[model samples]
Target: MRVSGGSTGGTPSGGDGRDRSDPQAFKRGRKVGQTVRGRLLAPGPQGLFWVNLAGHKLLAALDHEPSLGRELVFRIERLEPELLLRDITPPPSAVDDPALLLAALADARSRFEAVLHRGPPLFAETGAAGPNAPLAPLAARKRLFDWLASTPEAAGLYGRLRELLRLARAFLPVQAGRPVYLPWAFPGLDASEGLVTRSGRTFTLRLFGRLAEAGRVSGIFSLSMNRASYRLSLERPEAGEGLVAALTSVRLGHRELAPVCVHLGPLAPAESGGLFAPLIAGAARPFTGLRLRV
Candidate 1:
């Protein structure tokens, strides 16, 4: 049974089962564990304990299915905390006033609706498409699970989730599954070009300029990748304060903080040739620091 999206909740079957007890399996699993550990250690700020939960669940998923490494497929899902709270016990602090919490959630939802419709203010200037662009609005819903591993914010959120899973491993008999790393938070970047300094905060944007010159893309969306941390930050100039505020207010689920795949769907295959030069040059550029703090 080919389960979609790396849902590591099952046993390996058929010929794959022969390798379950192999020492190599344990080694691979250990590597995955280490990745989760590193993610938690590098969440960037203190006072932010909530970010490790997603990593914990990913590690847990890997423990359950060692076969994940063999498969080319990966899946990631993001869940709003309130949508999840009903399914799991809330932390003590959150347990006292479910009604108040719900009310806050409603207000947040209203605010989000207002802002999202207005579109991100900063991004507004850029005129980039939203999570539901190119494709029909309904089609975007199916791709929600794709956003988890794409952006630094989502990554930070995932790091917090993984930490939670590590904590629970001590008491819960949770199985470690295969590692399925997805890049949901990153949107539209299959690759890039230009120059970046190692661990620096700013990198030059070149490839997109070329693409724009050629009229391949509608316009350029600048992307910067930080080598040391593997963080990808996109310039969403249209994103307004409201979206930023929502980002600040957002909470991640311990099991899934960010969707790994934020599928904007495909561009015309013919247009892909137009992106190649930029993609190659961008990826080849040296690492530099990122300035995503806007």
Candidate 2:
């Protein structure tokens, strides 16, 4: 079960007849036998997968159903006919500790929040002007990406942010063959535009995030053109419930929209189950879920 390509060509080289060392080569163009790293964003129609390859979205055929958000290194198996990638990422070690993975995720989230705070103001006040305006979130994201490029220590967090941005981009509605840009009202917040759906004449934009308050807090904000709803789950439920009560009578403007709902409960369990789950189930199986006709 091998993925075929043009040929096992020689190593990529420069005009000087020496191997090129440009770190951004993958972004320029892919070559057969060249290795590239990408994160699986989501599944597409016909068993195809949407992969984020060096800031570019590409549709790829896989041999198995890869878990979403999984990062893998792939060798460019074929460039013509259809882009095929052979997973070359090494499997999780038998001694891999799930605790360490969880800790890393926590650290990444904290670092991401810190970066967001120091970079720019995420949300605009009612009458804010200049830099803190409604478009600030878009600018802030770009600045954060630039900062991540220069700060090597935040590499893990960078991937997570990139993944979130990719997810947000995926939800953008296309019009006239171009995506319609929806400005992020909360400007600099570290929330992903989770979903967008249209039914009848209403369009809804959903945002999701977990922030550190009195411990970690998870929230979902669903906004329509005329109304908004919020669902927040906090570590300290009583405090959040009190806050929601205080804002219950607050009006956004002259119009009274739908009532906002808040839910308080325990944090959802981690998706990765047992410590040895990946080891037992095999993390990188040959993708056989999607079949392509040549």
Candidate 3:
């Protein structure tokens, strides 16, 4: 296997014991939160560059232009199946101490105190647009951070605070006339094939697959639903079961809107001929979700 770095001096397997040069393959070994020190390469299109992070040509998209060839430290932020890092060298003290990182988050928390709320747009409702109100969890975490700061346990609160910030960002309120981007799905355990989006009372679900993406029919399943009884069927794709998940539930400013459940039977692909079919459609079958009123 071809591994890139000054020299790790060992064969790099693609984790299931296969030696391949796939960038995504070598990238999976590293986890978010781990720090890497590497040199930046020249910029690529759309503000992406290649940096040698922890002995690999890690891909990064930094806000500012980094010196072409300077050794720098970065903290892994999100694993886009690749690597997204942030400059941790601003305060070299934070390179090793999570407490310093927590301090940095605290500083950012102060600025994010007026972004989102769990329900309707508060600013529009009250016409009070200021930095006084923050997202619910963000504010809660900030207060918890202050309380923790006074205790001896303050030393180990970085992870908790970081995650709270991530969730807040992930579920950031989808504003009117804006597309709702779902939370990041697990590498293999998640599928967007049969996902549904609801705006007001109208539901739009994408269907059918592009014939060019998947060569032939893989499998087919049938599903039918109603108020009294329901039936489901599944025809796993060539890629595997490829079932869908609703774990990343979203709220669209309604009192009765809530996620029904997680994992469900696979949704068969629907391809009755279309130009906008998904590359790898679900089988000859399909999938769905339920909205409950209490």
Candidate 4:
């Protein structure tokens, strides 16, 4: 006889005097005394420690004071509403140093600016189509991660990134069951392309020149890669224009991220062909639309 409900607290079953340890047979059951990483969130209504681990939000009752927003390893014990956590332990090194996190965020902002200031807008001044587009940038960013690993700069914060590597690698690997999340805060990147660089506060207009077409002007073009997502767009200052037909493609490091033509709205022949060369040259498969375990 197959028992849908077990003898006791919904234990793993069909408990009819037989072992039902078949994982594929039923829903997953957590084994007692398993170690897992946990990130502590803000306090609850009762000031209870709220933790997130392996995409599970759990409550942790610790033997010692806890640091908020920091990840710690915890042992799991079964509980009804949520899992019970014990033996909570901190990571070996400090990973939440504010200064270093800020530096990393700042550096990323600068790289965006560098691309904006690489030169006049790619398509603004040239009609160099049919095979005359600038190549991809040599490097998108200085190896901030590599530098942190090798040097003592941002020692405390660097350690955090290192600690996350075990988890972080899961996100970008060619294939994996679980997806990874970036630790740093993402800044707002608006359509204006306005950025305040450390060297000096300045505004950059990528357009070298703009031509008026039938009471409308368009010259803004941008290619952006966020994590593993690649996006290319051509804008006309005014709306309701016809689509421009042309052939375009992007290749990154031997991978054809985008081997297709871009269609835009009524853009100059010269401008449309030349504008996206940099992005295509640097295009590679991005890390978006990943299915998370959650």
* TM-score for each predicted model, relative to the true structure: 0.20, 0.35, 0.25, 0.22
Residues 1-294 of candidate 2 have per-residue lDDT tens digits of 022222122322112333222223333566654556767666544455555666555545677766677676665555555555556443332114333333333444566666545543433332222332322144534555565445533433445433333322322234212112222333322432234455554444433333233233444444445766766555555555543553332123233345377555654444113112222233333344797899
How far is 266's C-alpha from truth in model 2 (Å)? Answer: 10
Runs of candidate 1 exceeding 4 Å displacement: 1-69, 73-75, 79-195, 199-205, 210-294
* Over 4 Å off, model 2: 1-35, 38-103, 111-139, 149-156, 160-215, 224-226, 235-294
Q: For each candidate, what is the lDDT?
A: 0.25, 0.43, 0.34, 0.32
Q: Measured by TM-score, how close is model 2 to the native structure?
A: 0.35
Q: Count backbone overlaps in model 2.
A: 6
Provide the lDDT at 38 for model 3: 71
lDDT of 1: 0.25
Clashes per candidate (backbone, < 3 Å): 61, 6, 8, 3
In the order shown, the candidates' Cα RMSDs to the true structure are 21.6, 14.3, 21.8, 19.5
Which is superior by lDDT, 2 or 3? 2
Residue-by-residue lDDT tens digits, candidate 4, 208-248: 22222222222222333311121123335342222121213
Encode model 1's per-residue lDDT on 78-97: one tens digit a residue.
33211111111122222233
Q: After superposition, how far is residue 68 of candidate 4 from its true place, in Å?
A: 2.1
lDDT of 3 at 47: 44
The TM-score obtained by model 3 is 0.25
